[model samples]
Target: MLKAMSGKMCSSSSILQAQKLVDQLQIEACMERFKISLTAADLVRYCQGHRRSDPLITGISSSSNPFKDKKTCVLL
Candidate 1:
């Protein structure tokens, strides 16, 4: 995606394209690669404590993960 956007002028069209690329790359297709499971309480806790984390105080857990998956998993 970055390759497609490289050397392009920073116009409104380019900015919108860049945003779309981010949504598709970093936001949509990140979790299937990791096979991680997350829950609602996890999201609430993260949002509640996001500002509280400092360099030394920040903690990350691979088990009982409290982070939201990047992909949108809609059940339709």
Candidate 2:
């Protein structure tokens, strides 16, 4: 995904893969590679980094998943 964006044209699959990332750092890396920027509020609304707490990589789980608790809410 990063390779495609950094090199030349990005395929549809690569875009799909990038959009699923929920890590702030990974998302920022993607944004940097694409040379895109967004405000904090817009970032939350357009990006899933703050909305989801999943692991950055596929098939991985968050190190500390608080959503397991019924009292936990993802909203800011």
Candidate 3:
């Protein structure tokens, strides 16, 4: 299965199809941990300029001051 789904040989559409099959097989819970691994890999690729934007990266970058405290918190 991995051979047929090799990254070098498969397009995004094929990968999506494979993911759907995996979902139907009810192994998504096992695959859940891989979501972070895949996101990290994509983030590394994005930082290296090998790929384009990801929502996770974009949301972090676009925030003006994510760490800022609220005015109410300051008065407390």
Ranking the candidates on lDDT from highest down gives 3, 1, 2
Give TM per candidate: 0.28, 0.21, 0.26
Model 1 reaches what TM-score against the true structure? 0.28
Query: What ranking emerges by TM-score with the best candidate at the front?
Result: 1, 3, 2
Tens-digit lDDT string for candidate 3 (1-76): 4344444766677788978998877875655565878899988877778335544555544345667554544454
Better of 1 and 3 by TM-score: 1
Give me the candidate number with maximum TM-score: 1
Candidate 2, 1-76: lDDT as tens digits: 3345667888788677667764656767776443245465666675565435435533334555665555667887
Question: What lDDT does candidate 3 reach at residue 47?
Answer: 79
Clashes of each: 0, 0, 0
Candidate 3, residue 74: CA error in Å?
A: 90
TM-score of model number 2: 0.21
By TM-score, the better pick of 1 and 2 is 1
Which stretches of model 3 miss by more than 4 angstroms? 1-8, 27-76
Give one digit per residue, the lDDT tens place, for model 1 in 1-76. 3333465546677778878998888866765553235566777677678746643456555554557475688998
Determine which window of 10 residues in candidate 2 has minimal summed lDDT. 51-60
